[model samples]
Target: MGCEAPATVGKLVAVNTSGSYLWEVPLETEKPSGGFGCAPAAIPAAIYGTPAVEVEEGLVYVGSYNGKIYAINSSSGALRWVYPREGNLQPVVGGAVVALGRVYIGSSSGTLYALDAVTGDKEWEFQTGDKIWSTST
Candidate 1:
Protein backbone atom coordinates (compact mmCIF):
# COMPACT_ATOMS: atom_id res chain seq x y z
CA MET A 1 0.00 0.00 0.00
CA GLY A 2 0.96 3.68 -0.34
CA CYS A 3 0.20 6.96 1.45
CA GLU A 4 0.00 10.61 0.40
CA ALA A 5 -0.09 13.13 3.20
CA PRO A 6 -2.56 15.96 2.76
CA ALA A 7 -1.09 19.14 1.32
CA THR A 8 -2.51 21.06 4.28
CA VAL A 9 0.09 22.44 6.66
CA GLY A 10 0.97 20.61 9.87
CA LYS A 11 3.59 20.73 12.55
CA LEU A 12 7.19 20.37 11.37
CA VAL A 13 9.15 18.49 13.98
CA ALA A 14 12.82 19.21 14.53
CA VAL A 15 14.81 16.60 16.35
CA ASN A 16 18.36 17.31 17.38
CA THR A 17 19.78 13.96 16.60
CA SER A 18 23.09 12.38 15.76
CA GLY A 19 21.58 10.68 12.74
CA SER A 20 18.99 11.44 10.07
CA TYR A 21 15.39 10.30 10.24
CA LEU A 22 14.93 6.58 9.94
CA TRP A 23 12.59 7.04 7.01
CA GLU A 24 9.93 9.20 5.49
CA VAL A 25 6.45 7.82 5.07
CA PRO A 26 6.66 8.15 1.30
CA LEU A 27 4.10 10.10 -0.59
CA GLU A 28 5.04 8.37 -3.77
CA THR A 29 7.53 5.72 -4.66
CA GLU A 30 10.21 6.21 -7.24
CA LYS A 31 9.55 4.51 -10.52
CA PRO A 32 11.64 1.44 -11.17
CA SER A 33 12.99 1.69 -14.68
CA GLY A 34 13.86 -1.97 -14.93
CA GLY A 35 14.55 -3.39 -11.52
CA PHE A 36 12.76 -4.73 -8.46
CA GLY A 37 11.19 -2.17 -6.10
CA CYS A 38 9.79 -1.99 -2.59
CA ALA A 39 7.14 0.35 -1.22
CA PRO A 40 6.47 1.16 2.39
CA ALA A 41 3.07 0.67 3.95
CA ALA A 42 0.45 3.38 4.30
CA ILE A 43 0.66 5.83 7.15
CA PRO A 44 -2.23 6.43 9.52
CA ALA A 45 -4.41 9.51 9.22
CA ALA A 46 -3.68 10.47 12.78
CA ILE A 47 -1.87 9.18 15.85
CA TYR A 48 -2.75 10.16 19.41
CA GLY A 49 -0.93 7.32 21.08
CA THR A 50 2.81 7.36 21.46
CA PRO A 51 4.86 4.59 19.82
CA ALA A 52 6.79 1.83 21.54
CA VAL A 53 10.06 0.42 20.33
CA GLU A 54 11.49 -3.05 20.82
CA VAL A 55 15.22 -2.58 20.60
CA GLU A 56 16.29 -6.18 20.65
CA GLU A 57 13.71 -7.08 18.05
CA GLY A 58 14.49 -4.02 15.91
CA LEU A 59 10.87 -3.02 15.69
CA VAL A 60 8.86 0.07 16.47
CA TYR A 61 5.19 -0.43 17.26
CA VAL A 62 2.46 2.19 16.92
CA GLY A 63 -1.31 2.22 16.69
CA SER A 64 -3.36 4.51 14.51
CA TYR A 65 -6.74 6.20 14.22
CA ASN A 66 -7.39 3.96 11.28
CA GLY A 67 -7.78 1.18 13.83
CA LYS A 68 -4.64 -0.75 13.08
CA ILE A 69 -1.41 -1.59 14.78
CA TYR A 70 1.82 -1.29 12.80
CA ALA A 71 5.19 -2.89 13.32
CA ILE A 72 7.92 -0.92 11.57
CA ASN A 73 11.59 -1.67 11.26
CA SER A 74 13.24 0.53 13.86
CA SER A 75 16.32 1.36 11.80
CA SER A 76 14.57 1.86 8.49
CA GLY A 77 11.04 2.72 9.57
CA ALA A 78 9.86 0.31 6.93
CA LEU A 79 6.58 -1.28 7.90
CA ARG A 80 6.96 -4.93 8.71
CA TRP A 81 3.31 -5.74 9.25
CA VAL A 82 -0.05 -4.54 10.52
CA TYR A 83 -2.49 -6.21 12.88
CA PRO A 84 -5.86 -7.50 11.77
CA ARG A 85 -4.30 -7.67 8.30
CA GLU A 86 -7.71 -6.80 6.94
CA GLY A 87 -7.78 -3.77 9.26
CA ASN A 88 -11.12 -2.13 10.28
CA LEU A 89 -10.31 -2.57 13.94
CA GLN A 90 -11.49 -0.02 16.53
CA PRO A 91 -9.51 3.20 16.67
CA VAL A 92 -6.40 2.65 18.74
CA VAL A 93 -6.58 5.53 21.22
CA GLY A 94 -3.94 4.35 23.64
CA GLY A 95 -0.26 3.77 23.06
CA ALA A 96 1.15 0.29 22.61
CA VAL A 97 3.39 -1.49 25.07
CA VAL A 98 5.87 -4.20 24.19
CA ALA A 99 6.57 -6.78 26.83
CA LEU A 100 7.83 -10.34 26.80
CA GLY A 101 6.91 -11.35 23.25
CA ARG A 102 3.71 -9.40 22.82
CA VAL A 103 2.49 -5.95 21.89
CA TYR A 104 -0.38 -4.72 24.07
CA ILE A 105 -2.60 -1.89 22.94
CA GLY A 106 -6.06 -0.44 23.66
CA SER A 107 -8.75 0.98 21.46
CA SER A 108 -11.64 3.43 21.63
CA SER A 109 -13.99 0.48 21.38
CA GLY A 110 -12.81 -0.58 24.83
CA THR A 111 -10.91 -3.55 23.56
CA LEU A 112 -7.34 -4.45 24.36
CA TYR A 113 -5.34 -6.47 21.91
CA ALA A 114 -2.27 -8.56 22.50
CA LEU A 115 -0.27 -9.30 19.39
CA ASP A 116 2.90 -11.12 18.56
CA ALA A 117 5.74 -8.64 18.58
CA VAL A 118 7.38 -10.01 15.48
CA THR A 119 4.34 -10.61 13.31
CA GLY A 120 1.53 -8.33 14.47
CA ASP A 121 -0.65 -11.38 14.77
CA LYS A 122 -3.42 -11.28 17.35
CA GLU A 123 -2.64 -13.52 20.28
CA TRP A 124 -5.78 -12.52 22.20
CA GLU A 125 -8.18 -9.69 22.95
CA PHE A 126 -10.06 -8.37 25.99
CA GLN A 127 -13.13 -6.17 26.07
CA THR A 128 -13.99 -3.68 28.78
CA GLY A 129 -17.24 -1.86 29.46
CA ASP A 130 -15.86 1.54 28.48
CA LYS A 131 -13.44 2.95 25.95
CA ILE A 132 -9.82 2.22 26.70
CA TRP A 133 -7.98 5.55 26.53
CA SER A 134 -5.05 4.97 28.80
CA THR A 135 -1.76 3.49 27.69
CA SER A 136 -1.03 0.02 28.93
CA THR A 137 1.73 -0.27 31.49
Candidate 2:
Protein backbone atom coordinates (compact mmCIF):
# COMPACT_ATOMS: atom_id res chain seq x y z
CA MET A 1 0.00 0.00 0.00
CA GLY A 2 0.89 3.70 -0.44
CA CYS A 3 0.04 7.05 1.13
CA GLU A 4 0.44 10.67 0.21
CA ALA A 5 0.34 13.74 2.38
CA PRO A 6 -2.89 15.76 2.28
CA ALA A 7 -1.83 17.89 -0.72
CA THR A 8 0.09 20.40 1.36
CA VAL A 9 3.12 20.14 -0.89
CA GLY A 10 4.90 17.23 0.79
CA LYS A 11 6.35 13.93 -0.35
CA LEU A 12 4.37 10.80 -1.20
CA VAL A 13 5.44 7.36 0.05
CA ALA A 14 4.83 3.97 -1.50
CA VAL A 15 5.89 0.58 -0.20
CA ASN A 16 6.24 -2.60 -2.20
CA THR A 17 7.43 -6.12 -1.40
CA SER A 18 9.07 -7.10 -4.67
CA GLY A 19 12.35 -5.39 -3.92
CA SER A 20 11.80 -4.58 -0.27
CA TYR A 21 11.60 -0.94 -1.17
CA LEU A 22 10.05 2.37 -0.22
CA TRP A 23 9.38 4.68 -3.14
CA GLU A 24 8.76 8.38 -2.97
CA VAL A 25 7.00 10.61 -5.46
CA PRO A 26 7.15 14.35 -5.28
CA LEU A 27 3.64 15.72 -5.61
CA GLU A 28 4.41 18.58 -7.96
CA THR A 29 7.15 16.95 -9.98
CA GLU A 30 5.70 13.43 -10.23
CA LYS A 31 9.31 12.39 -10.30
CA PRO A 32 9.89 9.16 -8.46
CA SER A 33 12.45 9.29 -5.71
CA GLY A 34 13.33 5.64 -5.80
CA GLY A 35 13.99 3.68 -2.62
CA PHE A 36 13.08 6.29 -0.08
CA GLY A 37 14.98 8.90 -2.10
CA CYS A 38 18.33 7.52 -1.05
CA ALA A 39 20.16 7.06 -4.27
CA PRO A 40 23.44 5.42 -3.24
CA ALA A 41 22.05 3.77 -0.15
CA ALA A 42 20.70 0.24 0.07
CA ILE A 43 16.99 -0.25 -0.38
CA PRO A 44 14.84 -1.04 2.65
CA ALA A 45 14.36 -4.73 3.43
CA ALA A 46 10.55 -4.67 3.25
CA ILE A 47 8.16 -1.98 4.33
CA TYR A 48 4.99 -3.30 5.90
CA GLY A 49 1.93 -1.49 7.25
CA THR A 50 1.31 2.21 6.79
CA PRO A 51 3.63 4.53 8.63
CA ALA A 52 2.18 5.73 11.90
CA VAL A 53 2.55 8.92 13.90
CA GLU A 54 4.02 11.80 12.00
CA VAL A 55 5.60 13.21 15.10
CA GLU A 56 7.44 16.43 15.84
CA GLU A 57 9.01 18.19 12.93
CA GLY A 58 9.46 15.81 9.97
CA LEU A 59 9.85 12.59 11.89
CA VAL A 60 7.61 9.63 11.03
CA TYR A 61 7.63 6.16 12.57
CA VAL A 62 7.04 2.93 10.70
CA GLY A 63 7.42 -0.82 11.36
CA SER A 64 8.98 -3.28 8.97
CA TYR A 65 9.34 -7.00 8.36
CA ASN A 66 13.05 -6.48 8.58
CA GLY A 67 12.33 -6.94 12.26
CA LYS A 68 12.88 -3.30 12.99
CA ILE A 69 11.17 0.05 13.39
CA TYR A 70 12.37 3.12 11.57
CA ALA A 71 12.10 6.82 12.28
CA ILE A 72 12.22 8.64 8.97
CA ASN A 73 12.21 12.22 7.90
CA SER A 74 8.86 13.03 6.39
CA SER A 75 9.93 15.54 3.76
CA SER A 76 13.14 13.92 2.60
CA GLY A 77 12.46 10.26 3.32
CA ALA A 78 15.76 10.02 5.10
CA LEU A 79 16.50 7.56 7.81
CA ARG A 80 16.67 9.14 11.21
CA TRP A 81 16.97 6.03 13.39
CA VAL A 82 16.38 2.29 13.50
CA TYR A 83 15.07 0.15 16.36
CA PRO A 84 15.74 -3.51 15.72
CA ARG A 85 13.79 -6.31 17.30
CA GLU A 86 15.66 -8.03 20.08
CA GLY A 87 13.47 -11.04 20.46
CA ASN A 88 12.98 -13.82 17.95
CA LEU A 89 10.01 -12.18 16.36
CA GLN A 90 9.10 -9.83 13.54
CA PRO A 91 7.63 -6.33 14.01
CA VAL A 92 5.07 -6.21 11.25
CA VAL A 93 1.25 -6.33 11.15
CA GLY A 94 0.89 -4.50 14.48
CA GLY A 95 1.16 -0.74 14.05
CA ALA A 96 3.11 1.68 16.21
CA VAL A 97 1.97 4.38 18.61
CA VAL A 98 3.68 7.60 19.67
CA ALA A 99 2.95 9.44 22.88
CA LEU A 100 4.71 11.39 25.61
CA GLY A 101 8.06 11.45 23.84
CA ARG A 102 8.00 7.72 23.21
CA VAL A 103 6.88 5.20 20.58
CA TYR A 104 4.88 2.14 21.41
CA ILE A 105 4.37 -0.97 19.28
CA GLY A 106 3.95 -4.71 19.56
CA SER A 107 5.85 -7.62 18.06
CA SER A 108 4.61 -10.92 16.69
CA SER A 109 6.05 -12.68 19.72
CA GLY A 110 3.44 -11.32 22.07
CA THR A 111 5.60 -8.48 23.37
CA LEU A 112 5.14 -4.75 23.30
CA TYR A 113 7.95 -2.23 23.34
CA ALA A 114 8.16 1.41 24.29
CA LEU A 115 11.05 3.40 22.95
CA ASP A 116 12.35 6.90 22.94
CA ALA A 117 10.65 8.54 20.03
CA VAL A 118 13.67 10.51 18.88
CA THR A 119 16.49 8.10 19.49
CA GLY A 120 14.92 4.68 18.82
CA ASP A 121 16.31 3.51 22.12
CA LYS A 122 14.31 1.06 24.12
CA GLU A 123 12.65 2.44 27.21
CA TRP A 124 10.64 -0.63 28.24
CA GLU A 125 8.69 -3.63 26.99
CA PHE A 126 5.65 -5.45 28.29
CA GLN A 127 4.60 -8.93 27.21
CA THR A 128 1.02 -10.07 26.90
CA GLY A 129 -0.74 -13.35 26.42
CA ASP A 130 -1.70 -12.52 22.85
CA LYS A 131 0.10 -10.32 20.41
CA ILE A 132 -0.94 -6.72 20.26
CA TRP A 133 -2.57 -6.44 16.84
CA SER A 134 -3.14 -2.68 17.00
CA THR A 135 -2.59 0.41 19.14
CA SER A 136 -3.67 4.01 19.69
CA THR A 137 -2.85 7.09 21.82
Best by lDDT: 1
Residue range 1-137, candidate 1, lDDT tens digits = 54455332211121227654335442122222231112243333355578887989988787766666778776765778878787367766679999999999998888988999998888999998788887988
Q: In order, what lDDT does every prediction score?
A: 0.68, 0.60
- lDDT for 34 in candidate 1 is 30
Which sections of candidate 1 miss by over 4 Å?
1-20, 26-44
Model 2: how far residue 131 lies from native, Å: 2.0
lDDT of 2 by residue, 8-31 (tens): 233346454574446563322222
Q: How many angstroms is residue 40 displaced in model 1 relative to the true structure, after the best TM-score fit?
A: 28
Q: Pick the candidate with the highest TM-score.
A: 1
Report the CA-based lDDT of candidate 1 relative to the real structure.
0.68
Ten contiguous residues minimizing lDDT sum, candidate 2: 26-35
